[model samples]
Target: MHAIIQSLCSLWQSSWQGMVMGELKYRKGSGGSGPYRVSASGRRIVRVSAVSPSGERMDLMLFPAAGFAVGGRKAEGGVYWHTFSADEVRQYSASVGDHNEIHQTESPIVSGFQIAEAMEGLEGKQDFRIRFHYPVRSGEAVSLRSEGKTVSGMTDVLCFVWEAL
Candidate 1:
């Protein structure tokens, strides 16, 4: 039964959850800014920091990332469009799958998908208004903060800025 059990474990691991996300990430925290207009049911909450914090201790707050207004406040030929989810946000070196690394998965670290890239100009048939100029990279995001604590309601978040590797 050893072989059977091993196979079962591997299968279970792959199918850990229906956590159907386009990618994965860990959220550290939002910039020291916020309360932007996100949507009719929520808020965007924005903050533009050139960089994040720095330290060796794991007990940090946010990641070393940056962000911009998801709306039209951007300058001509200096921005684009992008989108992300909460499951993608996470603490650094988090679990391989879903289940809440910060609160359930791993030993709670800070992280999230910050804006992977940003372009200057673009000309195409845009689909989403709230878009970025470039695509969100595997280890990139537009960082933000969670409300009321619990790392759940991490709204309109893009990336988490950590000190370093």
Candidate 2:
């Protein structure tokens, strides 16, 4: 995921411009495993595509962070709370090879991929769309809840919604 984001940034000739929205879709019978070849195109709205050796394809749409609203809808259903320690955040960043400065700060921001991984029952979904309203800092408490095909992560400093399609 870090490599994919870097590819997109390089294509755009920018540095951590941030994203407004993103979507991921997995092909049928394609377990969405890694070792993917990633590429990106477009300017205002970048379209990132990744293909795995096993023919699994993932398409991600990233909207630029400009003139976009930032807010989150309330999540419904059972809720679970989690707090990521600074060490945990650092470990995740190291594991993913994403040494972005923002994520290495004293109060590190949790990576979007980490947040996605924290959501339960997201596996086996054919498609899902996610919008990150704000950055979740390490040590900040986060609440997760799922209603049907939708899952949401809310924190005091950040919130995001993921809907399976």
Candidate 3:
């Protein structure tokens, strides 16, 4: 799950920088001024630092081990459910320039950005982390419940500058 989340974070950062998965270059090392790097320091959590071409920095953390144990408790608000179709997947893929084979699944995988967007009242630049336990297939439904002010399974660290360029 750590490796999977790391790869997804790489893909997300690449899209945020307006670059395709093939266009973004990666350096293999920790604490560097490169595209992005992932590291774990004797902690159960993993961190990923990414920088765009314009010098905007984003720090992402993955708590693969902290599943329903961390923010798993129920909160106020209804469960937000969403479903994506194969055609919608294709359209989004073209828009984001990400055509990974996993998107072709019967219940195609949805982007984290899209999931965050589905949550109401999350406008403007905001930094956040999301963990997906299951794939929301093309025809299947995926739901997100809230935990107090923040959405469940999401941690609000800071405001993130999303570049659509």
Evaluated at residue 104, the lDDT of candidate 1 is: 32
Number of the predicted model whose lDDT against the real structure is largest: 2
Query: Which parts of model 2 are misplaced by more than 4 Å?
Result: 1-14, 17-35, 43-45, 61-78, 120-127
lDDT of 3 by residue, 44-81 (tens): 34344555433434444434322322333333344444
Candidate 3, clashing residue pairs?
Answer: 107-137, 107-138, 108-138, 126-160, 127-158, 127-160
Better of 2 and 3 by TM-score: 2
Report the lDDT of model 1 for residue 43.
Answer: 19
Q: Which stretches of candidate 1 lie over 4 Å from their true place?
A: 1-78, 91-165
Q: What TM-score would every model get versus the actual structure?
A: 0.17, 0.66, 0.45
Report the error of model 2 at residue 86, Å: 1.8
Off by over 4 Å in 3: 1-49, 53-55, 58-77, 117-124, 153-165
Task: Tell me the RMSD of model 2 versus the true structure.
Answer: 4.5
